[model samples]
Target: PICLLDTIGKVFEKVIATRLSAAIEAAGGLSPEQYGFRKGKSTLDAISKVVKTAEEACAGSRWRGGSKSYCLVVTLDIRNAFNSADWSRTLEALQRFNIPGYLQRIAPNTSMVGFADDVAIVVVAKHLAAAEELANAAVRAVESWLTVAGLDLAAQKTEAVLISSRKAVETASVQVGGTTIRSQRAIKYLGVLIDTRLSFKEHLEYVQRKASGTAGALSRMLLNTRGPKQATRKLLTSVVTSQILYAAPAWAKAAQVKTYMRGVEATYRLCALRIACSFRTVSDEAALVIAGQVPLRELIRERAEIHTAVPGRHPRGHGGRGAAGRQRPEPQEGTGAGRDSQPSDEAGTSADPKRGHGSVQQMPTRGYVPIEVEEATAPFAVQAGQAAG
Candidate 1:
């Protein structure tokens, strides 16, 4: 019984939902673990929480001298969750949360780590059996609640994964509604693919394949002399790159591996070459410079840093200024005594690459070159000298 609301009705519905959400938030009725549909929270936060918890559990087990560190993540899918919600139970839950009676009367309708309807139950233990027991208990609790609320659990669609070291990997089972969900090597949650070992190799491969297809299409359309202008092609490349780097903060650490970094860089370099309208023989560094793009590795690191800086934004508080109470170091003053002791211009300025206008810096041999270099360098070099002069 799905009812499609008219334009005016949809607007009215949004207004009411907004007010109700504001009230609930002001009342502190939601748990911190909830990240679905809440303002100022995102899927990245949920993903980060899962990753951090798993890593911490594994690390703790290692420190205690046990090779049995493991994490079990069970993702539940509710079929038609919102449409199947019982209004009476919803109002009752709201009442239990101490929501206003007047608001409850007005709300006959409406709807993560539990985003909207995607729920992931995570548990970690030193032993596989212990982890399975904990996961099963949590699943049963959620199933009970869903039953009481008149929602159907899509057992077939639900997935379970046991995250652990390769040497300690073992199989486990989770049951819901009399169906056993076996552990898989990987599971996709909120558009990111998470594997049993958290190596993110599969996810990276997935991104590479998708990005390569996009780059291939763009390459065809953005030919050297036949397609969109450089600006237009670059804009398209940026959109594709953003899609490729979605949820980077959660899995960026995997880029530390040489193989992973190379795979990502190769895909990104293809886009850069397309945007720059350069030959395939161009070096990755040169292509990125021509395309006016930073390396994917640096970009991912920057995104991770930014995510950490936002308070209550990251799942785990790493020395970030937000609520973590980490004091940011004060900027040092430029003392007159050491002004001349600074590194020579040839050594280059320490300006952040993100803030700088161009990737290329002036060097002794290179002198000052135009920030934007082209396939043919002679004319640009002459232009560079004129601009510098």
Candidate 2:
């Protein structure tokens, strides 16, 4: 579960209550900001409200000036939250804002897909909406591009969701298509504790254990009485969810996981574990960024070729030119050398007219065109050829 620090004192009160209460309720319940869907107020306005609330709460409190200045402890639990969402349409809407420089400089490539639908993007934005828009635009662009390329986009669902964080607010939520999901709450919750000393390994192990336990419980509930295949399928499903949800921020930064059109905080243990585990094997920031922004399938399909490039095997040679270079021909007949040997026919032209125009005739490799020459010119032609030779 994640916790958003609405106000420093309010969050502190919840933390203190952790020792006494078995059931933990959010300090001010869940905030809409947790899911990146807060509206009717600017970010600054929201911050001001939170700050004022904290000050009031701290006024006569024992922990310093709990009212004058309070710490909003937003905790993010990265264990099993759906941070990497499939909100293709939202991304498209955000991309319409077009902060290309930010995307290229920060965000790299993003590819998302579901069944017959797929979207791939190569940009990033400084804020969640921008990032979301880019993904949305890519989804539409990909859908259209694929359609033109003889593929389908609308035959299946394409979607995405993202999480973002700042010192003042918490956010999370789900989205289907391009619109913000307003009806659903997060299946799981998260709470993040900043400035902690716990090692990544320890935290990761804990999350893994927790995920395993959850999966086991679901498996038992659905499989023992439900059957072996159902049980096994649920196990795999849980594992995949765990894998995406549990990553080290070091490998890929956690998205602002949102649900019900708002943001929330995750446990510090979860955030630390994700960050720690993320940096383990992956090394590139671009790869990590894409991992955070897009889904697993589309990324794999779109980048498999580029990601698998080998030494001495040029990318253009393997396929064709990219956005700029001259395209290399594929291994098909009548395309390369054979093209130069054939003279394209013009519509409505007679054979004689074509021949009269001195157009090169496409002769069959097995046959030849025969010509008869005048005897008077033969001697002069022969003399000229002989002199040149």
Candidate 3:
């Protein structure tokens, strides 16, 4: 096998794509659920969504009638996703959405998500059965829409993941277009490894391997620092670090993953050390200084510093001190995040203790399993912060 890697799409192609995508999006052609390929929405939006949903499902409340909730996330590539846009079906969809005809004419080889050719559907429910039904319904809707749009669902590559306590019962497998979607202990969704346990251990290992692989290739390319000058080292370092920290703030929630990110940066540190011909045992902080790179954890933390970072502002959402911090809809009384009856000193997204949701519950641990509820009425508040926001 042979393959040629080229610079992403050409400049002119991207300009054309940007113009067309903006138009389509403005016309409501793209779904909000598709955080990828959009200008403002990011991988964090998608990840936080699934995470918040899973957290809520695991934290069952009386309002949910005490049913343990679970989450199933399905990701699939639209067959020939890029060029699969059908003229007739597009027009049909446009009409169905009431998009004006003036904006409906798309050039050949144009599509939503431009070069990003995948989509993911997330379903959260109070029980495995509800989750499966919701997932099935969502898949059917997408399948029908794709068929109409001259697209096919790559069911073979479709991945189904169940997120719940280990004590929770196994769920029936999901089927798309008569092909059964295989279950995975951990599946990469929007570039993050998500396991049923939400431990983030699998994601950490995957990123470690990915960063390690990139470092190996770079090492060979640099000829062990016998080639490439400072500029090259800096550029390569940037590229490798970017790979390691792609969505750091999301998966970094796991403490162990946080520690591993630092180790990944160490590989970059070693490469830099060798480039400077310094000893491998040199302090990591010193190597980072020589490489002109920030520690991976600190890099993510610094990025977090840029957003609406005025004094007293929350990590996300639009607000300032004395302002009600922005949040997702608070989980309802019977929902997962609202199970506890005692309120915390700081608002745990609840103030009045009247509802059983008023208290701060113990966070999930390896041995501890809490009940959860799937409440469309209340998605968990406190979304994952946008890594690129």
Candidate 4:
């Protein structure tokens, strides 16, 4: 195979030299017919400098060479790298560093939108350290410039790995997969904009209507005992009851399978908790969707009781003993929870400890059972009011 040496540093040095030579010749260092340059010691010196700089950069990359270390050269193609628009602060920093306005104006334009507009940079570094640093710097620069232009940087993903070499450098090579790989993407939550003009009934209806359709379909599937539910039940039973939960292969060196089963059990517990909470606000139709015909009696006796502390159910008017929609015990008057019980204090009103409330106990009003007209019209009461006036 032929080798292509990417001598960016070399090219940069050569351009600098050629330009300098041209400038000198323009000032009459050599005649125009001599092309203002020649092949000599000076050329060799420039090449040597370029080679040394490139070597230093390569050394920084961290490759194991000389037939000892396995070498991996990774190239990261940044999807939408430039349009990431994270640069306003960076540009400000540059200004503080005295980068001129003209330079800022002439900075590269990133007009592409969506995933298509991302910038990609090809880096040649010897080790992971140098390669990642170079890639990160390039990414940051694109982000900063985009920020100045009032654009948002989209989510980005990266891939990197070392290529495997069989036998020797001159032999055929193939790709390899490692035991683990990690990747990340950006997410932004713009502020919620709720329109208050929608009537409470309208909002409730909107939610109920949305729930009906989804819940109806889900409920049907759960009740279809011969379908997915059967499969799920079998899976759960196997994990909980089978030998696989407690035993491993005869040749196994560790409890890898048992540990995995434990993980599955933990996940089931978490999911049960979520389902219990969701059942509270869900409409009857939606509740049926999730619970299906799985006899609530059996489920409560089985899965729902996993967390004894979490209340399973309560009478419509009865308050319970957990964080779930229960009336908290009223604290004594001067205590922290009761401090805001006063009506005159707005801070007390807004900071009411019952922040996540489904309902609150209303204070009793001054004593007044319904009054009869005959008692209400008593002459003494009328006379007293007139006398005071």
Candidate 5:
């Protein structure tokens, strides 16, 4: 009888759900910056904003307040974020924000502080020591606030990352409870690896490994099934590509990653050729034509544009490189990374005629005869690489 009554009671849940959400919003149950579980917003929005903030802070860390103020980002991993977010403590936090009400008011101490699971506290100060102290203060306050309300900080996972000028000789650490949190060169938050240098090399390598593994698995499937090449190609596009492109909108802003697009293109071309049983002499362009796969660089750029805020522009701050012009490292051989992709001042494409792999190749034209690049100079040829750098 109790089960039957429960089933019957749910019939009205639909009628009141909308009203319930509105009532909650009216009382400030959710902060504006919070996007989790909210309509018209996803975790990506939060991630993009956070990563952009990290980049800006990095720039400021290099040259803020007359060129000495660097920034520090301390990611606080509260063991069980949602499970531990006590209602009472949340209200107290609102009070700290002076969240416009008659009951209480306190000045907000942070420029950026909002997260349920992975909290990223952005501290931009003149010195590393000042930034470090600010970060620790947030932890202490939150730990005290949450502990009183039946939650505790996960000191084991909590760590700090300080980004300052390359030559800045400042180091700092934070302590939570008995746990003395140490600083790290790189830290993972929300599945993204952020380094103190913000190079994102680890992240690129991680995605490459994942995509490569998926591509290998797809290859195995091809051997077992007698299916059309289209099916295998679809699998590569949907699954393998997804693995490589996850969170690329924010991370791909690093120009050093541009060369990986070519690497990806090479991998796809090889996979397609094996299916067609094409000869080794076939060019990558021919293989891509056979597979109906879009150029990897184009694909990555399109996906990033779709998921992230403005591609090259920073979401905030005019002084920083923002996302588009963020970071471009000098291409060097032997690293197996991206090549020099500096574009001509006016032309959006890579200025140098050398295509994706950094190899100098003849750009085929209607009147021009086919010519192969000299083997000796092909591999090392760069697109005005040093002039741009």
Candidate 6:
């Protein structure tokens, strides 16, 4: 499918979108659970939330010494989401959120982390039946909302998955618009294959296959005797490697398993060997070093740390410096740098020794919070503050 947008119209759309996004953010019209098309949120954040919640639920069950816990994830498919959207409903939604009338005339545009039309509802419970019940209620709620919003839910394409650590889990299902959606062992959400145990084994295997194919294709064109130079080949290898590392932060833990690491390293080694123009017999570690490429494991860890350290994306709070602040090694006496030396802030200003770089004054307060907003009432809790002012 091809989408053609006039250059001028596209620029105008971006301007309008930016303005509308800022207004919505100020009023807190968006839910914290939402991660799509918003600043400081990504697929990694959504995946992390789901994985952590499922892990905690299963762990809680074991601690209680009773029935096992299960996490029910329902992914709903919407039919032609953008085309079917009701402009009137969107305008009304904006109005209800106390959005400026000028902005309401422009444009309108999940979670229960949605990216465009993809929406996943997650429910965790001690029993499978209870989990199913919760999932059914959530689905019904979504269906009703969609109906009112002039959208159609593609019940046939909807998928449900029951996440648990046990091998023999009783399959559970959810009812969606009179259609029964059975739970699967694994479901692909936002390009990542999430399985029952959240082990990400299937996802990693798929990545290895894809990475190997990409590297193999590039290798043929990048022969040692002819074709692209070593530097050019390495650049191409990095580009392909980045694709393989998509959502790496979410599945980094799974890479720790020896079996999983073996395949992943093999794929990485192939790319490294090609870049270094080395023999196949070279060790994976030596090949990566020779190519001046970071090991896959270390690369994944570094990416995960960066994701956590990013200001708005930090899981704990706004000011967390993540691994950078916590894990930075102290300077030795022989080194010119002092132990008390402070890192420069993003603005290039030297931070005070007493206060870390990410002090309260430096971190701006975020507009969105985790407070629940009932659809029946006016959305955007921040609207109250705006009204009072």
* Residue-level lDDT tens digits of model 5 in 1-389: 22333655455443333443444556544443444444454445545555654554445333534434445556665566544444454455444434444222221221112234555555555555655655665556556644555666677887666665566445568887777777777777566676666767776666666667777776766552455566545655456655555566666665346553545555566566655546558888887677555555655565454343232332221111232354444456865434334322211112122211121112111100111221132232211100000
Q: What is candidate 5's CA lDDT for residue 363?
A: 17
Candidate 4 residue lDDT tens string, 230-322? 436333322222221111111112222344234333333322323333433445445434533222222322221221222222212101212
Stretches off by above 4 angstroms in model 4 are 1-84, 88-149, 152-198, 224-330, 339-389
TM-score of each candidate? 0.73, 0.20, 0.66, 0.21, 0.61, 0.75
Cα lDDT of model 1 by residue, 69-89, tens digit: 566777877777545645575
Pick the TM-score winner: 6
- State which candidate, 1 or 6, has the greater TM-score: 6
Ranking by lDDT: 6, 1, 3, 5, 4, 2
Candidate 5: worst-modelled 10 consecutive residues by lDDT: 380-389
lDDT (Cα atoms) of all candidates against the true structure: 0.62, 0.26, 0.54, 0.27, 0.49, 0.62
lDDT of 1 at 272: 85
Taking the tens digit of each residue's C-alpha lDDT, what string does model 2 give over 1-389?
A: 65554698567554433421221112221122221211232222222222222223224434232222221211111111122332443233224334234332322243221111111111222333433333333334333433332333332222221222223332322232343432111111122111111112333444445655554454444432334453244334434343433322221212322321011112222222232233334444443353332333222222232222211122221111221143323335645433223323222111211111111111011100011111121221110000000
Which portions of model 2 miss their true places by more than 4 Å? 1-123, 127-132, 154-159, 168-389
Residue 291, model 3, lDDT:
60
Worst 10 residues of 3 by lDDT: 362-371
Off by over 4 Å in 3: 1-30, 60-68, 91-117, 167-171, 221-226, 255-265, 304-389
Superposition TM-score, candidate 6 onto the true structure = 0.75
Model 4 misses residue 368 by how many Å?
55
Tens digits of lDDT, candidate 6, 347-383:
2112112211111001001211111212212322211
Give lDDT tens digits, candidate 3, residues 225-311.
Answer: 367887676667556666766655556556445565555656667666655556767787887677655455655554344322321
